[model samples]
Target: MKRKYTAAAAVTVVATLSLAACSGGSSDQPSATADNKPVTLTMSTWNLANSPEFKTLADGFHAAHPNVTIELKDYDAAQYATLLTADLAAGTAPDILTMKNVTDMVTFASGGQLQDVSDVKLQSGIKGAASYKLDGKQYAIPYRIDGNVIYYNKDLFKAAGVPDPDGSWTWDDYTAAAEKLKTGLKTAGSAALPAYLHGWNALVQNFATAQVPASALKGDFGYMKPYYEQALKMQDGGLQLPFATVTANKTTYQAEFGKQQAAMEIMGTWYVATLLQQQAQGAADKFAWGMAPVPQRTSKTAGTSNTPITYGDPTGFAINVKTDQAKTAAAKQFLAYAESQEAALTLAKIGITPALTDDAVVKVYFGQSGIPSDDLTKFAWAKQKIDPQNPPSPKTATLNTVLSAMHSAIMTGSESIDKAISDAEAQYKNQVG
Candidate 1:
């Protein structure tokens, strides 16, 4: 499965853009229809055995066009960047490569490895589509959008007599709730911590940028100081696990929340599938949990009527530049099919958030078994404005690297918040300028 929490840590790859001598061959097989020729297109995916979205797209597209077959090439999810970089450099990459984020997409496009898919008919509701555009041409089409939300254990909240979040929560409200939960759980002799803040740079830095314009990230990250200060305060108060413990023990947000060790966790929508599957398989304790809108910076963007801002980079598909015309045509067809409403419904049934969302898609998504049926959960899931966690820019890779180190320094108390932010700004300016 794609653990989106760690997506911000993707390696920055600089590869040579040499064309491959050999390309995918088209076959005139018996399965070919009169209008469509028989062809097999190889697509790159990670954790193929667990990620059903890719299989669903491949199957759905193949059913529509019997002449084409999509063969998935799996890579290690954690080492996807390294493996894909090697493949691209060696001219062995699959015909269709999955663009995990805009940063890597920018890199691949800059290296001339991604073909322009500007003509692909994207659904009107597709999010983060503009981030895939490079030099006024579309290079990829987003298939899935995983926005951030706060998942809280409803049973834990009830047990502690703490009111459940109702979609209008500012950061102050969130912090107060955590403090109350900490005291209430301790008084009740429950071992669950108030919240779980995962040790990802994106958790703090990306949330800080959610309400700002994408251009604000270009040469400045001074906006991250307040978010970092709040995170450090939470860690100091023991409301959440410390960064050192989480990093040293390699603890995951899944185990922390699924095992009832934490009452609340702010994570991407992708966790819905994993949590539901884990509950059904008896890997997680049976608990009533619901997703609420992520806490806002202030009241201006908070409430059900207002769209809560969250951060997540859309996952898109791009055709390799080295592929032949027959395979390229087939790949484009697959990309268009991925943005269809039929594809949206298929993904919703499995709890994956598809890019093409509408009333019907929202209905199907909430209709799934084990999914939270509350109005608040539905509102949070359906009414979010997702911004690219890392916008597309040649300088983004360097900025991400510097900010990650800055996060570690601040959270671990090795450097003051101002000092860390200042250092990161200087480092980015020196490297990018």
Candidate 2:
């Protein structure tokens, strides 16, 4: 089903721009610097411009094309998304921009804001390309692929006499472990907490098989029911963070876990870097921790047509369709190199897992990187799998707001499940109409 989300995207453009027109030249065409004059191309991202990894990549781009200058439009991560949308609405979107995930890419693609790169080179063994495609057109240059994980305190599990998790672990196993941790564990602050929710949106994405419901505004949201029910079961049992408590604290789950207040959390692969840093520093609050595959559906929830699955996606750069031909060509070339195995190796050497699937390249990065405290990244290698993601309805940002509010209301005892779901669907219809 296709939806046109008008409110969240820039509605109409007085000027239509393409990164570079197809007629500009061959695919490998460089930006014109015919008079030996410098041509500068802008790349926008939430990453620190001077960070070692970015510096390495940028330096290599400049070194190879001495006539070209790379200007970084780095912004604070917290404000970058809002600023990016504002720039697009203002007709000042950069030549190349970093997108957070498939949702953000889909929003832009719906508005004809991203360049179609289906013609670009696709390297063998590179991964996660499908997550960034919309309507059969490639809208983003895929980079790193990340999957859901259960990051837990191993020492706490041992203290509670609960076994460490494995791939075979199911929802029943998770619930049992959480119950054990809740009853047996006490934090340094003398309060008892069983687990934390690292990300709410992740709860929406990490589960679901190929199924479509007749009336989910976007059929893609069909998976919301079982996952939400499972999470609520934990909340009702006092095994999950209270919505009121979490909102009052206003801190990341990482902060709560660092204080030894939580025994476990379900989060994505991005948290691995933080875990690596803590183990490397020998932080006192950091205890032995391990990673497990994100929980799978129990037999009770897995219908004959449904198979348990985890979600993985690419977060990377895309060319602005509005940029000039020369800059567009340059942007395409730069992304081409960045997605190569060579660039993947460079990204991985610094502990950033690349989207490349070469076993040799993956081994090089995971061999010593402290991603998992036990230095066992093999679990991650086996657990991670990427698939084509859903193209969110144009009203995604609005739908997310509605879903989140409804969930919070139900969790806090402010609304009944029947009332909340009905209200959410009604709002979805009215707002997305």
Candidate 3:
């Protein structure tokens, strides 16, 4: 997701660029400065107090390389880009910069603030690594990826006598299942919602792009119509919560699915961590649950025999251009370690989906306590194709802004799908063209 930069932050960046013209580019520091001596490197991260991924990676890397200390500099997740932009302008940004999405990487790269990390040999399993490349030069490498999947309450399905979802389900199959679940659940005297659709625009826009092609995001968004129609149909049928009600109540998907109020939810793999933590803390009820491949756009793409398409953004790390040669070397080492097999295991054990995953990583992930180990769950984890939610483009930010507004209008019944999409296209041409 993109965050708006404050005027002050923009001003700071412009001022820095002007000053940098007088001061010249970063000084060339030779690798001769690097040695086996102890060194401290700071890396930017978000929500360190609550999210432990950064610290876990840092500690694990430090444990293996005793001479290096990786210090984490935390910032508010919602305001991360704005704050990081300010820091970059002041020349006080962390030695290692954590890019939240492709847009942020583009911004940093275009500003000439990020070091070219093309030399870092990332694992082949990291599918989203190419998303960080611009002009044939790599800037960042992903450590973890959060792909979308259909998370279902197995116990709830059994209670309602509804069949559990498999890799073969298409959007039509999904709708039929939801309709059946709604009827069966009511007859069984259960109050659970058949499905829960989160309020985020990604819920609709990202799915549309993945099922079709991301290039649609750069053109007219006509590809999103059918998806919107299905979502609205479900909402109106009471198979899922209404967009307006969810927005007004500020409902969370965690509570909806965790409390058994929702039988199925389409969410990112990152929720695996939250659910496990909540169950352990007694915040969520313990029950049998598992993930399935998200419904496919067509029957041809809908099965274990075929690779189901889904959308997600990768979180990666980049190095600041101004860091000393010694720290730069150390920072690169940390990046390599972060995507290593050992690090993948550490992330998997904590319910986070590592980018560098293979059969071994899959074994570690399912072997973790409280994680479902059923065949369907394993299938969901092992196979699928992920498309970047945000494709690289200078005008991507404007396109997303237009799509988000279009999503809200259609989902809330404020405007017809055709009308909303039409308006968005006009806005896109006006601002992005």
Candidate 4:
């Protein structure tokens, strides 16, 4: 899933931009028809880097709907929201666009830019329309499921005299192995993405004991406080390295993790396929790394369930309300086909977990070639934790800004954990309320 500044932060941006109107409506509504008239629908997305897979999906959609043409527009992660906001304001936004969370859907839905998709049944045959339902109405479909897993270097584990992690292992066992591995290696025991950037994982992992349930908010920050506290304890206990040390001068998560600089990296399963591809090309040895669930919390009252919870980042297509009705209906048809079983399978081959809820379809889709059977099983197992309704915080973007600064302070020993949390809470309240 594409991480925006969290829902907490995104809400702040929306609030900031609320001063201006973000969409326009045309008086003419084109009639829907099965006519073969050529029509083009513009679609916007944030993953230009994954152009090949996206183009494949687009082509598949076009093939299914011969009369509708899709114009794919790519935007960098940082530039997408700003450009999209501008487009919405000028009444020239794409007919379909990608959204990260409910806050995003609400932002556009409230602005009257998105068409009501509640009545459009998914052609993919997935159950539970609740995943796409927002405020009593449906506006988008769940396209992919993403989650974080403990990706360990198998070679490193064996070298450290630690046994490989089985699915049944507990957090204590994980920490024991990590500590043992850190003794002989130059690298730290394990590494995690910066807390602010990974607030979604933090929220999901701590959902049970959280002051607020994961479902209460449009994004996941309400449950992140305890998660960060756990990280701090782990850092003090030497079970994991400080974020600053691992991230220092590191431009990308893959670069650092790929070099074996960290024995374990908490990352999404989507990157597993890419890593496997790299390993095949001899970029790295056939390391015996495997994924396991995050460790359980120490206290029972803490309510941290080790159900192997992870973050789910589902990207879907949404129609712009400003578009002509004929184009809108055609766009919906294209979206339905794009989200079908065949298209979903094509996406799964490229490491995206198909959003279709049917186990049979998912099995057939991942049963194909290019991806390892073991990895496919792992992906399928992880998909059970997919929580499309619980997206990252809209305040995350702003939280990330604060987190970046706070992380610097913590690593430098310039600020205490209590101070950091207090400061972050203040900023979060300011942004959201």
What digit string (tens of lDDT, one per residue) describes model 4 on residues 335-363? 66556666667676565655664555556
Q: What's model 3's TM-score? A: 0.91
Error of 4 at 163 (Å): 1.9
- Tell me the tens digit of each residue's lDDT in model 2 across 1-433: 1111122232211111123333322325443344535667777755452234555555555555555566666655556667788898888877877776567788888888889988777778776787677777888877676666677787787777667765556676788888877777753233646777643543543354322222244623445667666677887788877767777777576666766677887766656665666656765265777766656665432322333355666767788889887677677877776677766776777766677757666666666555453433355453354444443446556766877777777666798766776787788778877
Q: What is the lDDT of candidate 1?
A: 0.83
Residue 356 of model 1, lDDT score? 74
Q: Per-residue CA lDDT of candidate 1, range 21-51, in tens?
A: 2121112112233457678788888766567
- What C-alpha lDDT values do all the predictions have? 0.83, 0.63, 0.82, 0.55
lDDT of 3 by residue, 134-236 (tens): 8899999899888889999998899889989978998889989999999999989999989999899988888888887647556678898989988988999
What is the Å distance of residue 341 in model 1 from its true position?
0.8
Kindly report which residue stretches of model 2 are placed more than 4 angstroms away from their true locations once superposed: 1-39, 47-53, 63-67, 89-92, 184-192, 199-201, 204-223, 278-284, 299-308, 373-377, 387-392
The worst-scoring run of ten residues by lDDT in candidate 3 lies at 9-18
Model 2, residue 44: distance off in Å is: 0.4
Give stretches of model 3 more than 4 Å off: 1-34
Instruction: List residue ranges in candidate 1 displaced over 4 A.
Output: 1-34, 213-216
Judged by lDDT against the true structure, how good is candidate 4?
Answer: 0.55
